[model samples]
Target: MELPEWHGPTDDAELDAIERKAFADSAALQLHLSNKSRIHDGVILEQEATEGAKSNQNHIALKDNGCGEFHRLRTRRLPDWSLLKRSCNEHRTKVKYPAIKFGGQIVYSRTALEAEKATNELLRLIKSNTHAHSGNEPFPMGLDIEWKPTFRRGERPRKAAVIQICVSRSHCFVMHIIHSGIPPLLRSLLEDNSFVKVGVGITNDATKMFKDHNINIGALEELSSLANLKLGGTAINWGLGSLTESLTSMELEKPYKIRCGNWEVNVLSKEQLLYAATDAYVSWYLHQILKRIPENSCGDEKPNQANAIA
Candidate 1:
């Protein structure tokens, strides 16, 4: 599947810095693998790709055959995400590895996933022996937190899905929509100040937190409170996809994005879960980078208190 490409202005230094930091402090970095090996081997310990990538409803091939993620429909590929994928192995990949191309992706059976586990284990061995990349922290305390959202299946759909959550330990954090009635608890926990809840489109999360999870945080608290606190919300609204594009010049895979898939399936395939995880992680990860920089050095850091009702 074709992974979405964000074409926004990107400074190599910024990306390099984040990558260095991610591997330095992240569990994945601790594992010691190149970006590709990690995903193929360790990052996705429980998931495997199944199904080729396809177009998200937002995706549309232009007359020129070019696709658009915002103005038109989003493109998708069950394509492997090596852009951020990593592995601990330094051994040469077999002839078929790095088998990434643009397509929806072939679906896999649970049994097929077993094969992946074996491969990851081997890669882990290599990571264990590899030397460190520059800027690799022994045990940094950070994560990237990106997210992708979705709506509840078999319902009216007003309560959209915001299930994507990736944290950048350096690159991002691991994430989930978890709109399952726990938002208030998270918010109450955050009131302690040290709790430090961060997000890209946190307001959207907060609204869903209340709508789907009865968060009671209200629109203002969900959206503006963090901005008022000057913790998040700069020129962008924390739309992970938009922010990633703005920051990384990396447009993420958008296919199957607006398309409703079987999210509630009791047993989600590894590929499906990873797709969900990546979306959430990227958004959250972006801010983790922001928090490390001196506030004034970054762009307009908005008040976290000015939230809007969903």
Candidate 2:
């Protein structure tokens, strides 16, 4: 499990300015510790690594991973993300939220040729749609990925099995990449920076794409970052289901069975197709709503931190 990276002031000048402002305002910086013992130990080790000379010891040095995150190479332990996983699972319950469905046509492509044609059609829509963008603006598309679930411990997860993209409410393309290897044309489109892929935690999807298919997806716009910037509140992390509801007052229903179903199957069931299509459509639709919101419009609100099933 990957934790979100932290960005802090870089130089002493900026730090001094922050301290001066805090003193002038009679405010003190507050640090909240969720796990005191673990954090304290990690911090102590990190300080030692920075101040002490290199030693020929078998113990791994606690080093910063550029996000103020400390990691020991040989004694590393993966963080437990079950709580986050459970929060995501709760969003998928149909009983908790109303169902959100896409009325658009879902084009399922299983072969390399079919995927190429579908991708061409999607590109054509992006090129011709003046309503969505203007000169020199990136065409935004909702993107999501799915793979077969692995329950085995210490086993690497399977590669991405399905790639879903939607440029508008009228059409969505679900490419069964497990069956049809990523074709040259599809790779080209993904690598193109002109078309921006928008979704929650989309950077993770980009990483998975590179690891699995050797394809470097470019022009990614993370929905959470966009929301934090555009919504003009105390910056908060977001989840797809929660963000959709916040913007549109519409529930983005994600059924647990369909969401966790086998995406690598030869043929996707209607429920699976609808689930995939809706996820992409909601992402696109939410971006359309969020982009129009004027900055500093009293949009500040408590954030919903439920993890999106990306």
Candidate 3:
């Protein structure tokens, strides 16, 4: 018999149905095994059990027979993710804490001239922001990238469409790179060793940028790694939104629709612009906050203070 191919059922009802079927199949199999154990010859059953135990020694067959079924069940039993998302929203609504907002002048560039100007402006900001004594220390610029997401099976990933960079609390630049190819000045700024691009999973972002634009990013600072080094207790992987909330006690309003929207559009909507800007701004702001915390301070001990993003 041919195994069923998964087409990525994402809806709650479909997930529920799949989970029910998997459970029923497991129950039936268990009942069949119990009946066979009672009716079959003991010697034959023992031999079969011994063979099954031996199969565990073969990684390939073990994965095929054991881990495969385990993953299928685990995948099928996934919780209603939509419900969890709704609950998070509801929690924010109940708490009445304001969502993270960007208080900055946003520059959206779609032409080479505009991109170059933005790049120059970013360099100026870096110059003004860094101290003279901080020579050769890469100025941390909050960075993020977005692309048109693919939902269809076997679809090739679209090249990155947007690149956002925030240098100060008052300014952010969003480049529609998919429209305006990375210009020489913009490329130089990205490759400049004096600036450190900061974000979550920035290595992956750098890799994707290099793949799509052939422009290699220079220095990168992963916020998770920074947080691990600064904060006390066991280290944990940190996502941008979660880290923001952990540090600032504010929701980073990431509406699913806007987040997963088409970044390749000719002009971004107001919501998308804000979303992009706020992400970069928060990254920069969080870095400042983490930097202020002493190296030996336990984050859990000063929850009240740590939660406040100056």
Q: What TM-score against the true fold does each predicted structure earn? A: 0.38, 0.65, 0.66
Candidate closer to the true structure by TM-score (higher is better), 1 or 2: 2
Q: Write the per-residue lDDT of candidate 2 for residues 193-255, one digit (tens) a residue.
A: 988899998999999999999999999999988866665534545678766644543467666
C-alpha local distance difference test of each model: 0.33, 0.63, 0.64
- Of the two candidates 1 and 2, the one with more favorable lDDT, higher being better, is 2
Candidate 2, which segments miss by more than 4 Å at Cα? 1-97, 299-310
Positional deviation of 53 in candidate 2, in angstroms?
51
TM-score of 2: 0.65
Give the number of the best model, judged by TM-score. Answer: 3
Which tens-of-lDDT digit does each residue in 146-181 have in candidate 3?
Answer: 998887879999999999999876688889899999
lDDT value for candidate 3?
0.64
Which runs in model 3 stand beyond 4 Å of their true positions? 1-96, 132-136, 299-310
lDDT of 1 by residue, 84-138 (tens): 3334333323222121111221212122233234224323432543353224422
Q: List the residue pairs that clash in candidate 2.
A: none
Residue runs of model 1 more than 4 Å from their true location after superposition:
1-155, 158-193, 216-238, 257-259, 294-310
TM-score of 1: 0.38
Give per-candidate clash totals. Answer: 109, 0, 0
**For model 3, what is the alpha-carbon lDDT of residue 303?**
29
Model 2: lowest-lDDT 10 consecutive positions: 76-85
